[model samples]
Target chain A: MNIKEISEDRLVIFKDKNTLTIKEHEKLISLMQQIEESMMPILNVNVSYNAVTVQWDIFKMDVNDVKENIQTLIKNLDHIKIETLEKKIVEIPVCYDSEFGIDQDKFDMPIEELIELHTKNEYRVYMLGFLPGFMYLGGLDKRLYKERLDTPRKKIDKGSVGIAGGQTGVYPQNAPGGWNIIGRTPIEMVKEGIPIVRPGNYVKFNSITIDEYRRLNNDKNN
Target chain B: MIRIIKPGMYSSIQDLGRTGVEKFGQSESGAMNFRAMMLSNKMLDNPLSNPVIEMTIVGPEFEVLKDITIAVFGTEKIRLNGSIVSTASFIELKEGDHVKVGRLLDTRGYIAVDGRMNSNHILGSQSVHSQLLDIHPLRKGDVIKIDGANEASLEKKIMSKYPTVKTYKGKPVIRVMIGEDAERVKNLDSFFKESYTIQSDSNRMAIKLSGTKIEADEYDIVSDVTRLGLIQVTKDGNPMVLMNDRQTTGGYLRLGTVAKVDLPILADARLESLVYFEEISIEDARALYNEEMERIQGTYYLP
Candidate 1:
């Protein structure tokens, strides 16, 4: 493990490896949670594929002291065995009708085949960024992988499900994105003020009809 | 209460912004010009974190419904009841008074009232992220409610202009500290030697610069948590200074972060404004921060 200082108040803990497996990710998550629980001055902690960034209050502690403490914590992380963390499986209902799929024609397969390929598998939430509640999901069927649009659409509707490269996820908000859209979910991706699926959560997509999408969408609005 | 007669380019209510919430994919949305916001709030005897209306180049026109005292900072083109008034000072307004903030010479301006604004506090912040949250920016004919209006009888005083607030003229030199990938950048010297112009697309999220391509072997990095003033070098070989509304994390090579003391200057830079960069150590940056804070604390005075 290596710790690189971004600034006096922020540093990132990352391994030398290029990518991380699911098991390594769980360990990284445990180490992140431990750091958050132990450091009172830590303001926020965010994790990516194989790294964790720690931001803290500079006024409360010295940079050198914080660095040394993080080093000690890393040494201790190996001796401690962590239990399998509890993860919630969030079921998201999506409408795969060509009417909602703006870019369904981009794929070579038929609309029904596209839906089957999308809904048959479960995906894991690797991280969340780009937009609020927009999950960076892993575990896409290789057949579904496609390159992003060369010229991205100016505006993409919220809850629009799309695939780009090796990832598939839903747009949590209406914004400009480059992902190829296949379908959309009616339910709000962000409930209250928090995202529905967090880092360790699993997401399973359930196919629904266009009429069902409207009904659920209306119910959400009301 | 107040009503917006005309909502200028981009005006939104903001405070010091949210912390400890990046894990939820939330950006730290706040005032771009932190120093100006602090000055306005302090002048009104409000807490430093008090919400203020942040205005862009063009500012809003407000019709005061109740008697209140407000302070406008970082701009000189302000009018009270159709008469020009000095900015960076406390001004008392009675009901039915119309205050207009004209086109600002500075890139941004701030207006702080004496009471709490009645706005949505999602995840403990009044900062409006129209895309992420249900809140929207100020619009024409929108009514704003304040919790305790007409309360503070602030002494009418025209304060001195803060030295850190830069009204852009020539190319301003912004200082920075070493970043994690500074050594990896092949042409790091070009960042300091070349003068860049702020792109028109720049907003609260980031200020994109065009000039002097600072290249590297590769620009992608494992995404990680980002801070307020991080200077991210994109794949296009141009540098963009991450601002208040930057995402929680990004996947680009960071050259360095703008010094805490110099972020106000960056926030006040106008579109197409010339910019230069200089390097500073972390210790020096911290020292400058302390000096700026002391200057602010000692400068808050009344007649």
Candidate 2:
């Protein structure tokens, strides 16, 4: 683990590996909490797979002092008494009908087998981005992995479920995307600022018939 | 209440932003130009956090329903009841009065009423994020409710100091700081010595630029992290300056943040405008930011 200064003195970049485990994510969050408790005017902390960028008010604390404290904390990671984070599981219903799934035929496997493989595994919400309420989930089954489209779609409907590379996630809003779409969820505005499915939360997708989808969809949006 | 006779290019409600929701992948959706918004609110005796109508490209043609003072900010040819009006200053408006704004010189403008806008708030902000609020920009016939008093008081108008963009040889010179991958950037000379032109596709999300390539040692870093005013060097080596509606996180290597003081300048730059990012020390950036906060807080006092 190492701490690198970004953009002069405001943001500190912490990089570990190309990808981080859930525990590493938890550690970074806890470290940020410790810094906040120290009365540092930390504005925001952003974490990718292996990097955590800490944005702060440069005037509040000496940049060098903040860097030193972060280094010391990382060196003594084992001694840090950080509590475990709360885990949440969110259930998502996806409709994989022929009309909604534009690239369904791209997969050679039967739709049922594909759906079965998807539902059996749980995905971890590593981060949410690209669009509001959009989460990038990890833990896709190796057998169901697929590449993105050569030319991206002009507009992908909201609540569209997709798979790209080694990741599987759902789109919260309609926008241009190259991911391979397999289904669409009836949930409109899946999660707003309230953040129903936040980072570190586990997501489970359940397949439903068009009737059930319409029923949930007709319930005036999820 | 106000009625939109013409939607203009784009008009939506926004405040400072919805903070403390990055954990849920929320971007701080706010005014593209904070300085202009702050100044507009201050001049009109309005709360700084009150939601204002953010207009883009072509300004909207609207009518105020009550006797209230309104302020327009940023670079745009605006008229109140067919009369040319100055920006950063409050102009009295009356019932059924027509207010029209023309095409923007900077591609963005702002309209701040003397009070708050009655709109649904999600995540503790009146800001309208498409995903959060599920609403689009203002259109013709849309009614916006404001909380200003019924009677106009011209005495409430106050004056303050604000700076416009400085163009050195016809290019908007933007001051920036170093980014997270500052040490890894191998082409620092090209970044500073060479000027970049803003792309036309630039919007609230980011202002894309194409110029001298400043590729960092690493590009496939991480996804999903805080990036505001970050100048990200994409895999193709183009610089994209993230704005208020930027993603919560990204994977590209960022050069640094554009000083908040200069954000309004960047926002006012016209499409395809040439912009430069001159790096500055963090200490100077802090001092300037503090000065801006002070300027916005109590820019002027009215008797």
Candidate 3:
């Protein structure tokens, strides 16, 4: 694999591929996993779509030395093609009832069609951000697309799934959000105090009855 | 037990933040001005990562229920029973002693108690991410549990010679290490030459930059994990410098990240302050950070 690398003293920047294909992402993920498991005296790793920023703890050793170690590791990994994560589909239960789906009427399509389009295709968890456990899931079908609201709500309930423009995600906690809400999930993201849907996981949304939502919500509160 | 008599503007309990939680989509929510927190911790002979009261703009009013050694780092507006207490100096507090701090000279400050703080941690951190967890921000009438007494039984205190606070006289020049893909950024050659002012939309998550519309050659990029000090330039031509409360991943094209050593300086910068970035080697940044750390650890009273 070819790579373009640069550094600002202790911060190293590496970007080999312009586009982040699944294979390239898998390689980056596997590289990160290898780095995580290494005994290298690194500080933190910030992975972006195609570029990776690495910070090292200089107190432990020399920055150049750490860079050399990373180069060697990358070389060894280049010799072996890394495989993508094992396919694990997390089936999420989304309730699109009027009470839960505040933006049901705001949607362009009928509520039933909206839910059908949403639940049909599985989404790829690209990343998690904005809020803890707030997964930025890819694969939003164009038919269900909607831009964000002009005025953001001061409070979007936790477990509320929202759509903004071409993106869709779950609000892990009750917080201020700008996305258009279409449904609610009873899965408590706070169980582990963080979202468990690690990047690279496939998520399939399943429609559940309002009663089922109530049951799951009741189980969570208790 | 420390009872909060008045929970200042934004005073909250924060440590250095959690680690290895980026996989869970969590930003390491920690103290904004880490240097101030570190100095206070060093003064009390406490581990740098120990929990401390992170007060900002204004400070909190509290009653120390137990005698403890405390170190205040930041502005010199802190007082014990109305008597002014110099920052970076250790003060032995007796039971029932009331501590109050006035508005700070900087945007943020820190108060480090001698012992471990009784705080609730989620995902291996006691730091509060107001948007996600409720474990942060000291509340009124809430009781904070801390070590009953000063752990360092030293007869006297020796303070470090480091400046009590970092003051930005004017638009300061912050060093930046452009990412490898920085060549794809708009105005790459002149981005460093042009100056940018801190935008009002800045926060703990990131500092948005005004004046310069620093865009990238290609805007659409993969959303990836982020860290403190990463500068993400949005499509609107705004460059936001991520901080302690930054999200785990972002989609904006990054120009580069601010050096770790200069993060506190940027954090303490006032809104709309003039700022510039000088391209530097990562080694230079590390040297500066090491030099600063050495200065703080120079005259430690304890091993």
* Candidate whose TM-score is highest: 1
What's the lDDT for residue A222 in model 3? Answer: 88
Worst 10 residues of 3 chain B by lDDT: B161-170
* Most accurate candidate by lDDT: 1
**Model 3 / residue B2 / CA error / Å:** 2.3
Candidate ranking (lDDT, best to worst): 1, 2, 3
Q: Which TM-score values does chain B get in all models?
A: 0.93, 0.91, 0.89
Which sections of candidate 1 miss by over 4 Å? A110-113, B149-158, B164-170, B298-303
Point out the higher-scoring one by DockQ: 1 or 3: 1
RMSD of each: 2.6, 3.7, 3.5
Q: What is the docking quality class of candidate 2?
A: acceptable
What lDDT does the true structure give each of the candidates? 0.83, 0.75, 0.75
Model 1 over residues A22-101: C-alpha lDDT tens digits? Answer: 88887777778888888558987887877888888787887788778888888887877766777678999999888879
Q: What is the DockQ of each candidate?
A: 0.60, 0.46, 0.49
Q: Candidate 3 — which residues are off by over 4 angstroms?
A: A2-15, A42-56, A71-85, A104-108, B148-171, B180-201, B212-220, B271-273, B300-303
Estimate the overall C-alpha local distance difference test score of candidate 3: 0.75
The predicted structure with the larger DockQ, 2 or 3, is 3
Expressed as tens digits, the lDDT of each residue in A1-222 for candidate 2 is 677654533455455466667788777766655665656667666555655567666667777788887777776665866567666778989999978888888888899988998888888876666766777788899988888898999999888898888888878777888989999888754544454676667889999999999999889543
What tens-digit string does per-residue lDDT give for candidate 1 at B1-303? 789999988999999888878888888888887877887887877877789999998899999998778888867658999999877577878899999998988688888988888888888899987456778899999998887754546665666655634322456888889897788898888887888899999888898999988878989886666788999998899899998888877889979999888888888888998988888988888778777766666664433
The sequence of per-residue lDDT tens digits that candidate 3 reaches over residues A120-193 is 98887765666767777778999778888888999999889889888887888888878888899998764566
Error in Å for residue B264 of model 3 = 1.9
